[model samples]
Target: MSSDEVTDVIDPRPARRLDVPFQGFVVDMVSDEVDLGEAGGIVRREYVDHPGAVVVVALNEDGDVLLLRQYRHPVGAFLWEAPAGLLDLDGEDPHVAAARELAEEADMNAASWDVLLDLLPTPGGSNEAVRVYLARDLTPVPDDERHTREAEEADMVVVPVPLEEAAALALAGRLHNAATIAGVLAAAIGRASAWETLRPVDSPWEYRKN
Candidate 1:
């Protein structure tokens, strides 16, 4: 079979299940889950349905990446990340949401954008797909009068980090967000054509001088 036509042969089995609904989210409970009959059973199992989001790795003419440090209530701490947000409740385009989020969260706009990668934040539990985009030729947008409750609660600080330095910080575990790390790595490795290369790969996160 062609590579594209190749498929896995998964055995089927009976399993117990439960669904717990919430006001804004739902929990799926599964017991006596399917066993592939492997020695380790399954390295991962269970899938949670989630609304996907987009992350923009926007770079300016000066070669600085736009990053945000926002206060996360769940973590009860400030975390650095690229501008990102979930699709609209009515189901909006992921790219459109990325552009809108860049504008809404950063007060910035990009002249061009290209998708770098689509990744699952947590495949084992959540089906949250995060689409990372490389944005170049940025333009600043006028501050709008619109904002969301989440935005209002977020004390967002926009900082421009040199691409090289950003990668280094990520390797040092200073940049903890998975999507941001993936986006930066994608840009550094030249997978993202919209970003200019500033270094080479010495490690998964370390960039070498080019």
Candidate 2:
């Protein structure tokens, strides 16, 4: 079999030049022209230029995972999802960002954190990558420390489901959010292995670096 027939963990892409076709408040549509070496020739592709994000799978001592139900306008549905937020602030650590999202979105904090998974939900269309975190030893934020809610978050609802049940929901397609599905399933699998698959919170994210 040729080398191209075998899938590898890392596939080095060709060189490319990028230009933005449309810029939104939070994201931009970018077009790139790739140099596919002398044999393949050049090709153009367009995709969303995302800022990346962190997702938190906050697990309680009772083995329940915290979730948020908020209206996602793009999907036109109120979906149950893990707490997540973008890495909008320049130079902000992803771990810190994940912690902040847990507090702001779920009014909770965790004493232990581990990297559960990293994923590109729409690799064919967008450069958006998300790191899912497993947070345990949970505690609620103080009333005064809670972030003021606005927009869709103003009506956001928090729910706690057993970790196994959440995994079932993901398999049944009841949980529509990408991060929540991936996080729940990954957490379930990791727990079965006594979390040996977990990575340190500070572990480098190669997708973000690229």
Candidate 3:
């Protein structure tokens, strides 16, 4: 099958957003006004329209997963998370973005990449979504090739946790980041399948343009 065809996804019909009134870095605020025809009532709901992103689950030979500790001003905490980045670059593949972030944040490279899971973390309030990639066969980039860190990332800490411990932290609620929690659990499931269950790194991203 082609990369654009996702056999696992069943979608005969889907809703498409028609109105976008605002856009910003934090979130693209939008208002959807609706009418209740029965009683002639009207309603408006405001929400965030995200550009989506990718998260990487980088694992080594011993099954240790690379994680990052970075301070987020909004949450007022230095949270532990898998390396991830926004899909801000036009025409960039999600898998490529994931690999770029893993290198930038962890100074490592992966020879194998697969889509572990796709999640809409907060569908009730936002169209923000994340695609988690499982990356293995790790290698470290040469020091000269590593990207320079800035801003919050300048103080970021890279830590590798055993797969079991990482899963525990995610399941027990210690891993507060949404992508990290989902990625760890998804990796656990992928391990059970001997990694055969994972989708191709370039699997169809039906929601990328939504």
Candidate 4:
């Protein structure tokens, strides 16, 4: 089976990076020297720097999951994804960011939240990480409370699809986007097995803790 089983216990070590000149809500590039005691002492790597992110697996009362279809310029394809966003707000709590993304991207709100899964897209090269939240107890944003969309957030299609169908699309690689693929399948298997609730919303993530 192709899988990444967690086997290393990272020892706390100091890291250093030189800032690159790029202006954006999230870091685009980084120069890093990370200490991996088990693999090697201190190895240098340069890759994209992501502020981490959140994916909202919001389920409506009708048992449908919210999703968005957006045009990705890089991939040159319209990708289906869950409501997600970067941790751009300084000192902002991750759960709050997740809620904000759900409202901004889907024009909806969730009253209940659970830490469904954690994702590290490129642990070997990038420190990017994301938390998937299972959001239930749905509510809609007031007409006057909708967010003004821009850039990638603008002109996207939002729809609700049944959770099982969504999972099948993901497992078949039709979903494509890492966040959507992970979020859909995790939520599906998790719900079937009554998944363990381990990490809290405020759990400290080591990948982005630096």
Per-candidate TM-score against the hidden true structure: 0.72, 0.92, 0.85, 0.84
* Highest TM-score against the true fold, candidate: 2
| Model 2, residue 9: C-alpha shift (Å) | 5.5
lDDT of 3: 0.86
Query: Deviation in angstroms for 182 in model 2?
Result: 0.8
Q: Which has the greatest lDDT?
A: 2
- Against the reference, the lDDT scores of all candidates come to 0.71, 0.90, 0.86, 0.83
Please give, for residues 51-112, the per-residue lDDT of candidate 2 as tens digits. Answer: 88999999999999999999999879999999999988877899999999999999999999
lDDT tens per residue, model 3, 1-210: 787885555342223345778877756888776564557566666788788899999999999999999999989999999999998877888888888999999999999998998888887688787899999999999999999999999988999999889999988878899889889988988897898779987787776743
lDDT of 4 by residue, 19-114 (tens): 554545566777767787876888877777777898999999987899999988988999989999888766778899999999999999998888
What candidate 1 gets wrong by more than 4 Å, as runs, is 1-17, 21-47, 144-154, 191-210
Per-residue lDDT tens digits for candidate 1, residues 60-128, read: 999889999888777777888999987645546566788889988888888888776667677566646
lDDT of 1 at 116: 68
Deviation in Å, model 2, residue 125 alpha carbon: 1.2
Superposed Cα deviation of residue 194, candidate 2 (Å) = 1.0
Runs in model 3 lying further than 4 Å from the true structure? 1-22, 34-42
